[model samples]
Target: MNISLAQKARQNRIAALEYLRRTKQGAEAEGEVLNFFAHRAREKAKPVFFSVRARMDDERIAA
Candidate 1:
């Protein structure tokens, strides 16, 4: 399933906040968390690159 950019950004921010809380960084880590999420969002905004390959059945072709 594909999620919208805004949804993904929101999720990233939530995760960053959770990490900050878990690490007990408190308010001091606020900037770091925001930067991390901003970078994550930018990374996600990049286009996805992939490749597809076709598999051939040798036995069927021989028959």
Candidate 2:
């Protein structure tokens, strides 16, 4: 692999870890960080299926 390509890959990894660290620090809402990663994963062509629901939502009972 070319040096330039390797450097770019390293930078990407470091940036990703930094973003995760910020999430751990609570710099942004937890949902925001999670959604950001989900969007990026899709852009990178990852196959991910997930279900999300708000914790405050009231449950419905079938009659």
Candidate 3:
């Protein structure tokens, strides 16, 4: 589905908040300042991640 610019901006803000949480700086803010920080944080924020899986039994045996 197509998302609007504002919606995308909000999404970016949420991601930035999550990043802030990771770095122990998840204080709430608002308005232009929030958007500005969101944009900046989003730019520097790392991507979402999943943990690596353990090796399967067969693979472990081959090693």
State the local distance difference test value for candidate 2.
0.68
- Report the number of the highest-TM-score candidate: 1
If the candidates were sorted by their TM-score against the true structure, best first, what order would they fall in?
Answer: 1, 2, 3
Clashes of each: 0, 0, 0
C-alpha TM-scores of all predictions: 0.38, 0.37, 0.37
lDDT of each: 0.70, 0.68, 0.69
Candidate 1 clashing pairs? Answer: none
Residue lDDT tens for model 2, 11-35: 9999999988887778455545456
Model 1 stretches with alpha carbons more than 4 Å out: 25-63
The collision pairs in model 2 are: none
Candidate 1: what lDDT?
0.70
Per-residue CA lDDT of model 3 for 1-63, tens digit only, reads 999999999999999988877555433432234466767987786887544443465567788
> Of 1 and 2, which scores higher on TM-score?
1
Angstrom error of the Cα, residue 45, model 1: value is 47
lDDT of 1 by residue, 1-63 (tens): 999999999999999989977776654566444467767887786786544422235445666
- Quote the RMSD, in angstroms, for model 1: 17.3
